[model samples]
Target chain A: MKAFPAIAIASGKGGTGKTTVAIHLAALLAAQGRAVQYLDCDVEEPNGHLFLKPKMERSESVGIPVPVVDAAQCTSCGKCAEVCEFNAIAMLKKPLVFPELCHGCGACALVCPVGAIRETSRAIGVVETGRTGTIGFAQGRLNVGEPMAPPLIRAVKARRNPDAIALFDSPPGTSCPVVATVRDADLVVLVTEPTPFGLHDLALAVDTFRPMGKPMGVVVNRADDDRRVQDYCQAENLPVLAELPDDRRVAETYARGELVFDRLPEWRDRFDALWSRIEECL
Target chain B: MKVVITSSNKTLADPIDMHFGRAKFFILADTETGKAVVHDNAQNLHAAQGAGIQSAETVAKLGAEVVITGSVGPKAYKALQAAGIKIALLEAVCPGTEALRRFKDKELPVLDKPNSEGHWV
Candidate 1:
């Protein structure tokens, strides 16, 4: 068995082709006879499933334990409220727990003097696993109105297969959810375009991931659209792994839930080269 | 009956604050004695989340039977309602004392549902 390297595809700004690059790379790798696992860590709105078209095998609910107060045992001491940093718990003659605002740190339960506070798991999302040919596919779907995504993202990442290459499709921006997706990845591919917004957010993502001491490379989608991305990469001494052309066909195919490698056979070589460059960085 | 009104300033002549959760002060006044006490709500003004819930808890702890404000979010409305606090909407910006007078004279309308969306503050 070969040691599988986990690579995370992330972007600073949304719609920068993170999913487009991830699914293509995963498909190309699996086509090369290597076992691969594709995990969509964008729990807020997972879309990789649309392209992968994996069979719906099974799903497991994910949740965090929120404190529930027993009114009969509660003395209205206000200690639970005082210990809550998120202000999720409040005592107004009785303890009231706002589950929406809770981070599920369980501090309130620990501080309850009367042992009135107990934790109850509230479902926030679900992790679904299936297969697209030989490629393992998993994604997290956060329930509507649920504010938290890190817990579900963690659940998705926990399904990582050490026996195969793991490719993670992280959510946009440099928030906590993105961190949860790319934290321990072997290599992080920062996808960007040749635009001011892309460069600005790319810099923010670099600032966030660089401090973690992880090796990173940039992929400039719609490469011929602008030269600024290449110029920025050169100035920053970052490796340019792949440059995808700005083709309307690629966009149209993606919109129709199709893979670039499948629609355009010529691009399979390009994704194969992208994987090699990522290997060099690792 | 004790009434609480969100205010921008501590004085009775100050304008009623349009925001409920982020208001500077909550004036707790007695309808019969006309005695008003100002409770500073500066701590919750800078809260990143759940300011409305904390603000609702503050007034409920102060033993206010009624609340008068320009707008109320769902979380605060739920908390106030659970605390058995009657909510009255001012509809327009007016002096804090005027809002109290309207409440006493039955000119203000009771709010059964939240007027503004959550996180409005």
Candidate 2:
């Protein structure tokens, strides 16, 4: 069976309605009797569960490999410290390993002359899997004060169901976590506002990921009479997928942890139209 | 006693850098012999993380028994303390020579705790 396209909903700035677009898209796809799995890759602070209210039944702790030094077999040669690019290891009398600073590159263990260093799992976050009605849902929650998010993001994305359509709710900004989310996606839907600030960040998002050469389109959220975003998308040859109206009622429904397509019956047609545009992009 | 002071440049007249991790240079001085050496620290300035720890390692490897700086983060403070190095905390916006002068006069406060948080830019 041909798998449905994996769509990643992303934004250059936070609170740009990336999750708002993603959950809505997932809901629309499921409404069409198609299998849908929503992967919330914003591990640092995932909020989609608020709307979907998925009953997470299974959870697994996620971690990266940090070095465990064997003192008996070790010397104070400081070879591990020399090879570490992240400064995760240090030579304090004997070699010291700081788990928080470690990136799990395994270079320290590789360079150990005595083979004293071994890899051990250092738990950084947790990934939970569940369902919101028929829609499969998974989200990564980075432990408070966790220095990195990409590892946990990868873990969350690993739960993507290939048999169903995958919708990735990416973290804000065009950084590593965002890249990790949209890297394997068949389509990336950039949800943006219509003001000048939105245009500036949209340009940044375009510049950062356009080189990746993924098929991308824009959905103007909270769109009013602003023509800046539409004009910029046209000039860049980027498809303007849809324009979500700046409706106060939509915000009121959102504040109560509700879905736009559910509360605002008229909005269902808009989301359905969005899925049509997404299929066109694919 | 050997003392390491974070500095902006190689010269003793230059003001001591307020930031320990991103400091441009380190002046290692022998209190008894009145001799000192300048060590370049351009590598740790752009380091993404653990700059303070690596800087502390440099200070330790230089055989400096005492560290006098504007402030140090928790990692640097712990690293230096682990190596049995005495740390004196000073907030003076002065030259390395002046800092040393105050150190000799016992005017600067010796640190028993880290004054700043980690990732100190």
State TM-scores per candidate: 0.95, 0.95
Error of 2 at A123 (Å): 1.8
Candidate 1 lDDT over A1-282, as tens digits, reads: 127889999999999999999999888888888999999999888999999999979899999999999999998899999889988876776877889889899899898888998999989999999999999999999998788899999999998877889999999999999999999899999999988999999999999999888789999998775788888889988899999888899899989999887779888888888888998888
Ten-residue region with minimum lDDT total, candidate 2 chain A: A1-10
lDDT of 1 at B22: 83
Q: What is the lDDT of residue A248 in candidate 2?
A: 95
Residues B1-121, model 1: lDDT tens digits: 9999999999889999988888899999999999999999999999988899899999998999999998989888888877889899888999998998999999999999988888733
When summed lDDT is taken over every stretch of 10 residues in candidate 1 chain B, the lowest stretch is: B112-121
Structure candidate 1, residue pairs in collision: none
Error of 1 at A267 (Å): 0.8
lDDT (C-alpha) at residue A158 in model 1: 91
Tens-place lDDT digits, model 2, residues A166-254: 99999999899999998998888998999877889988888877999888999999999989999999999999999999999989989
Candidate 2 displacement at residue A51 in angstroms: 0.4
Give per-residue lDDT, candidate 1, residue B47: 90
Candidate 2 docking class: medium
